[model samples]
Target: MPEFSDELCARLREAFQRTRYDADGVLEALGAAAHAALGRGEPELAFRVSRYAGELGTLIRLFLLGGSEPSAEVEAALAPVTIEDALAVGLLRADGESLAAGLDIRPHGDEQGEWWVISDLDSDLLGGEVPPEHVLGVGHASLSLIRATIRRPVGTLLDLGTGCGVQALHGARHARRVTATDVSARALALADATFRLNGLDVELARGEWFAPVARRRFDQIVCNPPFVVGPPRVDYTYRDSGLAGDDASALVVRQLPAFLTEGGVGQLLASWLHVDGEDWADRVTRWLPPRADAWFVQRDVADPGLYVGTWLRDAGIDPRSPEGRAKASAWLDWFADNKVQGVGFGFVTLRRAEVAHPTIVCEDLRHAFDDPLGPEAGGWLDRVAWLREHGDDLLATRFRVPATVLLETVAGPGEEGWETTIRRLHRTDGPGWQHELDELATALLAGCRGALPLSDLLELLSFAHGDSVEELQDAALPMVRELVRHGMLEAA
Candidate 1:
């Protein structure tokens, strides 16, 4: 682990700034193509491009590309922080006359700001399998959680499995106080160093799940837990929870409400099993506790073979290798014995609320979203709460469709000229959801302009279609509720 102190961290920050070793600086040094290649785990282009990029290039080669540079060059690149101090803090190791990075430190940023993250070198860079307790750097899953997280300002935030403290860094931007916990000691140490280097104060604790924060409640919580489903064996501390099958995800979901304040929100990435002769949504929905509103959006599903192979490759094990073959066989046999047909991966958002009937939605949302989901998630919670409050008088509420909502129609040439084949309502923003509509539903929706209540619209439609008002109201209310749930309609 790296030794951390206020003075040492300040000196390192100065060195990084002097060399311009950040996301933007790196992009400038290495052209757009090479920078993107580096992101894809191919460092050949970066190695060639950064050969003449000056001090910034040297820092990039040493820290990111996993290259060894002469001691003199490394010392010059780290001007304020001396070579002795760097070596003492375990940031560098001497190989003859050249110095190599002891750990992986890469620049990471989002819309909020830029900062450096420290962790163990990836398995690809290490040229073999990583250790059991390896702390992971920023990867695809980390970035996905960062983008999917709801970032509203809150009093206190909890980052559950803060592996390298990436989520905590982002939480500090909007949260008044942040506390991060992990079961791995190495992860906690690297997380501490990461927070100190960025000049942010985050409370760090060591425990399993929510043990460290027992009896404490938070306004918001974000987690990307070790949710990989597998046999009860821990190969990696960052991906496996040593629980059989998807029990780890179930445990986290079941325990969320106890640690959240009233009306608090919790967002996390999880994996669940799709067992034989069972509905996946029902399996996941059963994990929710009472007095809580929850939403599960499954983005992808993989069959048993694909799921096993994917995780095996992620652990740096070649499927053709002897050890890999054995592990895969045993994993597949376990899946067969447990009757797991596939695995589903997605995001879960939960809100702790006291209500008679909580809004629990479990659906598959595989569409690509253009806008950030943070705002959409907050808006969904607010809209659902509003709908629940006005459930008794929903017929009297004035509703209006947002401008982003579009009515799409597909037409085909029939014997009677052009005829409508399909009618659908599409939301152009957020999740890009589409719902099929019938002629009656379309006519009723056209009347939702905020000037009249739903009951009035139903009466007008009944008079125009020559049907009873009660019959029209019963038919339109369900469609209106569905539209409101997806943000297609809003109360005036």
Candidate 2:
């Protein structure tokens, strides 16, 4: 580690020893650490920083709760220790040897927010599940989602891939009981140390994904599972499941339904590959919980060479290093020859949306987590499938959609102030508005009362007007969804 980074870690230890968990001071320090990690420009650190920015929500919650306090100053005379502010900074290095040696998380803390137990990291912390040195620590994104997506009070929560018990420690606040499980006893031990240091009480289990917690179900489950594609390595247990490459994510997605309550939530940080034969949307659409609702977003996709090189670099396999070139070369060639189009990375939140219908909706959204999603995410979760369920009903209600409504194009604009369709008809200067009385002739009655669902809404318009339903729906759903998501429109 760099000398400055070492000093930075020492100051945090000193602060903790002083029990000065000052809320704002803590956040500031962690925020600075996240930036510092990014400043190094290492790939793993870059990935970790992006993740930290995303997981800031988890910190806010910790701050509000008593577990963390503002960093104090004798001058201010009111500062105290805060867990949220110290997020990444308080993180202790894992004992690579201990993790491989079989020491798992043991019980030594308050079981609520006080103490925890673990063997040294070198022996059993990661259990040979070595992450890329670049990551040095857990990615910040994993922490961000748990903080952002968790809203309601939870009774029992499970943190899969409990690398160091960060989620478990955080979950302990809202959940009556929190359990952090990992296939690596080494990881379990690290979590134990983390919880202990934070004075958090949590149950730690050592077993494969879902296997250890199979018999018990919880009110909420949060996983930062090993969701990357490809085969597993001795140390890849932290990321690669023994399952087929890419199937790793699917395995967890497939099992989530069985592990959740009728209305429970599952939040995860995962990566899925864009396979040769299909669309990523279609690939994940098949992973939906039969009775559950999901919000799946594709943030970015990197092609095969990019994907392979990325992971290779992550694992510390520097092609330029003394003995890394040949090894890394072989790995890169494998992905390219396989025609792997890309790898998709993002966060997913699933809730058991109690509806009579099974609807799957997917969108490609690359935006900040705070993308105008109001206080309650349940709305976004529900509205995603709302149109399909009630769309037909709205179409059936003659009172729902009116026939006389004008048919105007959304972007067909030559006229500055006209609807494109009107402009198209009149060849208006900037934008034009046209009264497609003839267009409404057929479409108006089809969805007149709201009987025409958005899907068919387009078909009806095409019959009556000049444009296709596909075109209209593509444009209208987004505009209307924002309205519905924000409570602007009630489901007809």
Write the residue-wise lDDT of candidate 2 on 1-492 in tens digits: 111133343443454434334333334534666435534543243333333432232222222111221232211221132323323333322223210112222222222433223322221123232443112233455435554456568888888878766567667777888888887755665565556555567888888789988878788888877776654443456556666556777777778767887778887777776768888888887877577777675666777666666665565555576556665566556555656677888767777656776545556656443432212355565655666555545433222322222334455446676443421122121111122223343343335344444556556566766777667655555544443443433444
Candidate 1, residues 1-492, lDDT tens digits: the string is: 656788998988998999999999999999999999987879999999998899999999999998999999999998888999988878888878899998899899987679999898887767787889999998888888887888888999999999999999999999999999999999999999999999999999999999999999999999999999979989999999999999899989999888999999999999999999999999999999999999898988999899888888887888889989999999999999999989999989999999889999888887677676777778888878988989778799999999999999999999999999899999999888789998889898898999999999888988898999998888888788889989999888
The Cα RMSD in angstroms, rounded to one decimal, for candidate 2 relative to the true structure is: 11.4
The TM-scores of all predictions, comma-separated, are 0.97, 0.61
Q: Which parts of model 2 are misplaced by more than 4 Å? A: 1-23, 26-136, 232-234, 353-356, 367-377, 384-488
- Model 2: which ten-residue window has the lowest total lDDT? 424-433
- Give the number of the best model, judged by lDDT: 1
Error of 2 at 206 (Å): 0.8
